[model samples]
Target chain A: MHLYRYEENPLITPNDVPPHHDGFEVIGAFNAGVAKFQGEVLLLLRVAERPMSDDPNIVKAPVWNPETGKVDVYEFRKDDPRYDFSDPRVIKEAGAERFLYLTSLSYLRLARSQDGRRFTIDDRPFVYPSNELETFGIEDPRITYIDGTYYIYFSAVSPKGVGEAMVSTTDFRTVTHHGMIFAPENKDVLIFPEKINGKYYALHRPVPRSNGRPEVWIAESENLLHWGNHRFLFGLREGKWDSARIGGGAVPIKTEHGWLELYHGASDDHRYCMGAVLLDLNDPAKVIARSERPLVEPEADYEVNGFFGRVVFSCGALVDGDVVKMYYGAADTSMACVELKLDEILDSLVKV
Target chain B: MHLYRYEENPLITPNDVPPHHDGFEVIGAFNAGVAKFQGEVLLLLRVAERPMSDDPNIVKAPVWNPETGKVDVYEFRKDDPRYDFSDPRVIKEAGAERFLYLTSLSYLRLARSQDGRRFTIDDRPFVYPSNELETFGIEDPRITYIDGTYYIYFSAVSPKGVGEAMVSTTDFRTVTHHGMIFAPENKDVLIFPEKINGKYYALHRPVPRSNGRPEVWIAESENLLHWGNHRFLFGLREGKWDSARIGGGAVPIKTEHGWLELYHGASDDHRYCMGAVLLDLNDPAKVIARSERPLVEPEADYEVNGFFGRVVFSCGALVDGDVVKMYYGAADTSMACVELKLDEILDSLVKV
Candidate 1:
């Protein structure tokens, strides 16, 4: 397997993007959904921000209150036995249900690049948490340019549940909310650019409470709204890189071999790596081949350390001739890119 | 305010209904969804059956295996620290996600009555746990007869999540599944018998994990398969008889004033009672009035004792002129009926 790492490795850092609100600060700028528009590559960057806090004993959780139309900070004392803030990303209340609050709220911000290298970040957020379903804020946007509309699907978190929502834009000016397509405890959904076998297909990772682990499942839809015929596609490899959980990464790229899908997998210790899965062209639910080893792992200095460490999560990618331009979130902090040869990736896959 | 208890109470008991499979016993036969078809009263009973395990240290959980099309038993040792069987109904695993498996699996069995008092329980299940979503079992069904078709909405539970699913039958011979109408962490859905203002209305209770308690919500649909425009209807009352959690019970009865809905409410200590809520005729989402006190509480010995004590949950009722024939599940073990005056219920509700 061959990977060409960019010299300007960490393309867009948290310092590159400014916060949407006054009291908030940019914590992470990564896991962007990408597309090509108007001769420039567009990145729907997941910009995470948090309230300015100095006290070590106090934990501040920022949430977009739909009633107030602004961000509200919920402060919890570290000494409180009712709340657990051991996980830096989420605050869990001590209960059977385990009420969760995010440490930082995320929004999708637009970033433009002419050569798919140097980027200019937007001042305002492209898509902010607007409804009660997204009160905890949105994260990990995956953009699929279908027909004339750019469909951006992201994880909408709230007390209701963690479900996937869709927002579409035709000219990058007006946006329309399509509500929640998939129900909660589910995320990392990627819609294919085109329909397969007369029905729209999507790859989703449903976090099961029991029986099975979090695995990639395929669903079919007629109007891209009401989905059914859910089938289990594939799961994590036991005692391997993806032994813990796995999810769909970038949208599947169509090639002569099959539908090539680059997916992210995590080990037991929460170390994320990217791998590939190839599916049958006609019946996308049928697995054809899969990656024996991860194509991209947390190896770079940027990937090894940041807001969160040892993670390389991809949301979108583009194929140019025989080269695949893949953009991923490193350490859950900043955006980065790596180029992979299509032929080499096809050869590396182990046939199912 | 007024209730006429049937003299021959506990209409259907576990002993009345025989087990479908060998080496199994009917533990509970309750929560019957009522309907009148061809001058006969029909009760879709939630019959819970479990394996006859004689060993006190061992617990056997029965699951409908779709692959083998047979009931499979999963045995767990009482001394196993990995599993918690203190609830007696559910076996929870020691994990953050809290994997759950039901102690006894339930399915809908048809019970026919000529006089709405004496009934004949079916030998086989009318609607069993067929799919993976209903692996844990289908419970608490609410039936609504609209345009010559009987629509039965019930809770489908599994490791995936607890969601509301729909099943329809015209003659009770052939059944059709409409898949999951609502996503996980949701149940207790009751569809109105008739459309309101050219749209179908449903009352559902979504179990929120973080912000709100389990509250009743209203949703509208055109095709009944895809639902949207979800709005919160009402929630639990503090320091009241119905304080813990509330959910829609039977199909709403349409009257001149409004649509009268009988609902079940539980206390913090798990004492279930029946209450009423009146909604506007044209706009069913608007609350007109609600019961200040429970119309039916756990008063009888059957309701106060059994498998699950102090529970009086209703699923269906029939309106005959000014008198309403209500069917309820007593203590999650047996079914019972009560006669309620329509005008008395409307008068008892406190205006909003």
Candidate 2:
């Protein structure tokens, strides 16, 4: 497959924003929602703030000490079996629930661009984890345009697990949080471009049962809040390069081929890459064709080494004509963008 | 995952068969049709045969010499880029369908035992590749017993691609081939034990598009010959250990929980292992539950190093009371057996 890399790759870096805590860094800076608002390219970025220490020699690490109502340092060991400091996303004991210490806390940051190249980011986080379940973070924001309203779907992670939540804004400053549309342990919630057969269609990743692999499911609703007709769409690849896990990335784009979607794939090693699949426009659950090779991989220094290594995660992309401008998180530390001609990518896909 | 190896490990070895053909190894041997016939356990094994040569200079090894009408041999190097002999089942070009050299030739072989322990194997091959498309070999046979008749489903391979074929035998001696049931570029065909909702169901692995990952698809039939209603059942796990490829191993067994089935998984490294899944009894296509960890893996020397290493393949298993006797091929060379208490195995599965 012919691949294109940005000249100024690793466009976003770890130093872009300082961490809120001492032991973590700010990561997962992505465009949660994007649209032409007020005659400008507006982007809602999910900037994740995590603990900042990478050294194991420093036994004590800073954490949000709930009991003390302040950030406190706790002592752990380099060889501690209970804590897996090696993993950037999760840390846990053998029997305990996996906890994420560092995540892109749901703060809807703003960015503006004229040529869609250089973006000027807002100084403050736009949105924060308001609810108890969202104490951990909010992540992977997908923007869907319905009528004149812009709906933002993001992942809300907490002790309860990750769930899909939506918030809408007509004017950037005045936003209306729409509560959780789907249950917990759900993410990658992408709203279909338009209503299907007079019903709102959305693609969601729900971990229906604990300890089981997560799969893509579809739900329909008369209104956006109450969803029904829950049907399983896709599951993890059993014994292939993608056998590890998968998640919804950018919002589904409607094209002549179908609902084109760019998705992220992780192997057991947690190396993240991006691929695409075409879903039947009428029936979003029906997969038309999918790409055999990943559209984007972790090849740059920022992508291969950071808060997390070998990760190329995207939660939003903007389609202009036949080209798709994708903004992604590299190594969970910085943001980057790559452009692909939609027709060329679709043409490279293998059809069954 | 807690794994238990058979006490009498490596219960079957390559030396069990005659060694005249310079390692006429028994590989891809599956339980095709097992029955309590004439006071003995009759098993149809799909034994894969290949000549063994120690030479490493000549890269292109001939499997069958058409001019001489005999099996031919050649040499292959581990460092050769044009041909990769790394994969045991398939050794294809870097990104092409052309294979390096034929390393295995599959044919059906018969074995019988009065006590399900000590067995007697027939010296002659029962089924061999007949057409040009099936010149490579046949492998992974699944048998279904319906109305006092035995029907066998197996993979037929050639330069064209791997496809599923059917054959029937009532008394072992008189066999009738049913030609190809599925088109080329497919394998792991398994027929449901009985009709569901007045229609026959079968599970097949199809690579409908080249270079794309394989997926499980379901088909329905009225006469068990012409199948329709072909629909997607499941895809491989993305970013997991078994995220690469998956295929049906043994025939589905009827249970109160659902249609219990043992399936095989391969990682990107091509290590094959066994797992179980439950499908809705009434709707055989709906997956009810699946095992998170593999029930069996290649650990022993015979299982880790032989004609192919790190492989444990199965096509047949017999349930007696609450015990399931799994007959599997180890390291693509010998037949081995493992006894699993049905309820214990079910306990390990993730219920959905």
Best model per TM-score:
1
Model 2 per-residue lDDT tens digits across residues A200-305: 8777765432123455666666657545444556667755445677877888888898889888888888888998888887888788787677888888887898
For model 1, the stretches where C-alpha displacement exceeds 4 angstroms are A94-100, A207-213, A229-238, A256-258, B94-100, B158-161, B183-185, B194-201, B205-222, B228-245, B255-259, B278-293, B347-352
lDDT of 2 by residue, B1-352 (tens): 3444566655445455543245554444443445556677766776665555555643334355445555555556757777666555556566554454466676776778876766687777666665544566667677788887788778766544455677787776777876666654457878887899998888877553211246676777665654444445666786654688898888888888888888888888889988888899899879888888789888877679877778888787888998888878787767777788788887888876
TM-score of each model, paired residue for residue: 0.91, 0.48
Misplaced by over 4 Å in model 2 are: A1-352, B1-9, B19-35, B59-82, B88-91, B94-100, B210-212, B239-241
Error of 1 at A235 (Å): 4.3
Please tell me which predicted candidate would have the highest lDDT against the true structure.
Answer: 1
